[model samples]
Target chain A: MANADRIAGSDVFRPNLTGRHATGRFWQTAFLGATTVGILGLILLMLNIVNNAFGLVAYADGEDYLKYSPIPVEQLATSDLVVLLTNELSTGAINKLNAEQPLDTRSRSDLLALVFERILDREVVASSTLAEAVFNRQAFEADALAKNPDARFVFKSWVTTDFLTVPMSSQALFAGVRTAILGSLMLIGLTIAIALPIGTGAAIYLQEYADKSLINRIIETNIYNLAGVPSIVYGMLGLAVFVRVLEPLTSGAMFGATDTNGRTILSAALTMALLVLPVIIVNAQEALKAVPDSLRQAAYGVGATRWQTIWHHVLPQAIPGVLTGSILAVSRAIGETAPLIVIGASTFITADPSGPFSGFTALPIQIYNWTVQPQAEFRNLAGAAILVLLVLLLTLNASAIILRNRLSARRAN
Target chain B: MTQALSSLPVTDPQDRHVDWAARLRRKPRPVETVVQGLLFLCGAISILTTLGILLVLGNESLAFFTDPEVNVFEFFTGTHWQPQTGDFGVWPLVNATLMTSAIAMVVAMPLGIFAAIYLSEYAAPRAKAILKPTLEILAGIPTVVFGFFALTFITPLLRSIFGEDTVQIYNNASAGLVMGLMIVPLIASMSEDALSAVPRTLREGAYGLGATKLETTVQVVLPAALSGLVAAFIIGVSRAVGETMIVAIAAGATSQLTFNPFEAAETITGHIARISGGDLSYGSLDYTSLFALALTLFVITLGLNLVSRWLVNRFREQYD
Candidate 1:
């Protein structure tokens, strides 16, 4: 220690301290800036969607509804609303809607929304984004009044509880994502059901049973390559296979459907299942590979056969991992737009999917259709639907993450 | 239960034999063989899916080529892509796809690399755990949402800043920018893996020579991880090329042969989507054209993916 102190006092040589500090500081700032760019992009995305979801809308009820209503609009009873709609709408329009789905089976709110959209033709005269409504409220009111003198202004949220329950419509004010949500749920359910067992089985064969042969290597490589294939390619596969070649089954023609053909929930679900299969297999392989050999040895030591050991011990240990993987795949499938679009998901279907063979549209398709509309309010509707999709996606992801974490925590003990 | 079992008298040897026989009798004779066959079938499904994709794409694409109206030479060399009439030139669509992907790479590469450096080298463990998932969540967001964001939010911001004349209502720049954001996490996570994989001994060696932290990271670690970084970049490029919803919704669906990012241009994926959504009948030339475009996309992405996986494997081998 005395010798080191003596050498420090002598100060034989020194590095360029200031230049080094400056370089370190500069790099630190640069990296921090990069992280901020990503984080800011996420924040901006959320803000942009949230901002459009709420705003002031100036709506004008159809001329006939305004003239013939006996009482105020909001206070009208459900039966009275139905009668008003029946009286106001053309019989052809009412029949067409009923043929699509019976109006009597619809909820009261749905009926009311239908009354406004079909019979009353409630029109958005002028709409301001959330920012404009917040900062320039009086200006917006004046502009809206100038545009339509009789139009009533209201602070409306595009993403309401009612939004989740009502079906799609032409009028932006009455459009909802209930049908789309139901279709998405059905697709997710079918995808998980089809993909989980097949994917895990493949993983087990590759990890536990397969010998290092040429065919095995080829299959293994093919799985990796398929995982990187663009989603749109899978769409083409679905179109050709499920929608075309197997149309008799996918379209329910085998089950006696006469009109609908190929563009059914079954085709979309099958496509999504294939699209997520590689993902599930890859994840399951990783999870299965993580299991210690000692566990297998112990099972063998107890005179258990390979399948018995796998089913009783290894499979139980791998369940949480498999579930985590399935959840991730579900999230991917539910949000997938390209494949479903290619496989002919309807852009404007109002009827909920009643069976696997039923024609369907998903949330992403709904959002896409609304965004392309000429009406500014449809963009808000798109934003609202995006919020719904995000919430759904996050809830699924959160549950899976929480489950995986708890399982891993238990394993740590 | 353990105490009661221990307190019981030992069972007779014959009873144990009977129990073993009973268990053996109960076992299904064909269960294991059936399960193994089932697993083999499951594994074969992935291979069959690949063949099916190839067959489907090739079958329809050949049909598209053999049609009397579609000249094979014009399909590749011709610049215009007016499939509604008779012009099936794919170059314009390819050009637009490349332009959007190029812009996305421009936005993503530097930011992704630096973010990776920060996460791998600079972040404390707690910060890293939080930041990593946040980035992943950003990645997990549906691309359709990004399309709406690009159209409603970004284009307006650009218009206000650059004038309405410069930024169109639907242009490639907004879509490309948001697509870049969508892929930033992908690139960041992959590159972070590469950066963190650099041996600690190398960093220590540089530090021992009086090198600064920045000097060691940039000079020693980054150079060693270059192959992995290139792999990451290539993967990002492939992802940007295949991206559909953002370009379809935000970039106008007009098939214009222009190099301008500010102008409206349609990508190959966008063109397929727009065309397929129409009322074209089954077996029509227009509908068949969708398959041809998808074939092109499939081939391009497959090649890019092969190269990326090769590079990644090479990188891993080097470290191992």
Candidate 2:
């Protein structure tokens, strides 16, 4: 200690601490800039979506049917709404609607929507982005008025309850994501059903059953490679195997639908299942590996067979972990686009997919389709659809994450 | 369960232990045998998927290359890629893919590394708790959403900044920039793991010498995790190359060999999506060309992944 104290004297070489501390603080702030960039990217992405989703829309013609009605639009009864629609709509249009479904039988909201749909042919002539509407509304309105003197400018959110339930129309204002959302749900449900069991089985085989053989090694290594393969390649595989080689099965020819080809929900679902298989297997294997050796030893010590040990002890404990993996797989499958596009998602599908044999279009596919259209309103439609898709993914993921946290908390206990 | 157990045919209690041991030693029950076979089949399915991809791509690509209309030498060496005009140079598509990936790396590399350093070296526990899941959600967002941002948000902003003549409505810059954002979480998370895995003793040694936190982190820790960081970088580049939707949506359909980010050009993935999305006949030359492009993509990404895995394994051995 005396030698160190002597070395610390003014005669010895000195180190600069204050400057070094300043440098450290600067670097720390600089590192925080990284998080700031991430934050800005996220905020910008949301802002872009919001900018397109809600804006001032210039309608070329009547959306003022509310002024004609004596009651406030929201307070109008179903019969009153029907009467308003009857007064404004052509008898032919009313008859066609009645034939589709009686107006009296429709919900009040539905009747009100019909009033807008039938009485007021509200064709949006011009639109300004959310930013322009918010920041430069006077200028935007003046410009819009120059183009269409009679145009009624109303701030509108393109995404609404009516927009979600109705099928897409030729009119951008009337187009909805009903078919796309349904196709996505059906595809995801079927993909999980096919993938979860197969993936879990594969993981079990690799983790528990397979011995150290060359074939097992090959299979194990093959999965790692398959997981890295571009999803478009998987789509090519699906295009060949499911849509071509197995056309009779996927096209429902065996089920007496010989008129159609193999581009159906079944083929798409099978493709998605294959695409996510590796991810599910890898995750499930990680989950299985977390099960301690003692659990298996205890089961075997009691005269249980290998399968009995797996079923009674290991699998029960592994279920939560396995479920977490399935949720990841679900998310991947939901977000995947290129493969579905490659396997040929129908661009114009509107009919509700009735069976596996039905043609399909997912939410992503719908978004892609809408975004490519040359019209500004179509671009707005795409934005609204993107919001719907994000909401769907958010709900599913939120629930799954919550469930995972709960399971982990319980385990910690 | 007791009733089922009691229903089993039983011998005397004295003989039961031997019988039980014998049963345990016996070949698995039929149900067990069937289940094992099913599992083995499931395991092999991934292998079949790989083989299936190889077969389909190879077969159609073979047909395309062998056709009298195509010269294999020209396909590789040509400079132009108008499929209808009989010029089949793949370099344009390949070039666009590389250019966009290069642009993506430019945006992602520094931000990702810095984020990793912050998360591993400087973040408080409370900060991490929020930041981690937020990053995960960002990672989990669909690339199609990113595509929308590129088209509606980025393209306009670029146009406004650079002048309308300077930026194409559908340009590589927007797609690349948004894709960079999409990949930030991947690189950050992976590199953060590499940073975290650096042994603490080394940092402490540097600190013991009165070195600053930043100096210790930059000099002592980063060099140690260099291999893992490289692996993460390679993986990120591979992901950017394979990314399809953003390019398809924002990057224009023109297949040109140019380094300019403001100009639009089709990437290999984008070209494939564009051609396939059109109403080309089932057995057309264009249809087959997609498979060949897909084969190229697969090979590139596969090679990248193999290298990354190798590096990651080597990195793990150092610490483990």
lDDT of 1 by residue, A1-413 (tens): 99766654664433456667888999899997998899999999999998888899999976555576866666787777777777878899889878866777776777777777766678999877899889999998998889888888889999998888878888788779999999999989998999999999999999889999998899899998898888888988998899999999999999998789898999988888889999999889888988888999999776677788889878878877888789889888878898888888999888889999999999999999998896789988998999999999988888888988898788678
Candidate 1: stretches off by over 4 Å: A1-15, A64-66, A77-79, A89-114, A402-413, B1-29, B317-320
Interface RMSD of 1: 2.2
- Residue-by-residue lDDT tens digits, candidate 1, B1-320: 24634564567664654564465446675877898889988999999999999999999999999999999999889899997689999998999899989888988999899999999989999999888888887888888888888999899988899999998998998889988998899999999999988989889999998688899999999999888899989899899989999999999989989988999999999988888776668788988898999999989988998999898787663544
- After superposing candidate 2, which stretches have Cα over 4 Å from the reference? A2-15, A62-100, A107-121, A402-413, B1-23, B315-317
Deviation in Å, model 1, residue A254 alpha carbon: 1.7
The CAPRI classification for model 2 reads as medium
Q: Looking at model 1 chain A, which ten-residue stretch has the lowest summed lDDT?
A: A7-16
lDDT of 2 at A135: 99
RMSD of 1: 4.8
Error of 2 at B65 (Å): 0.8
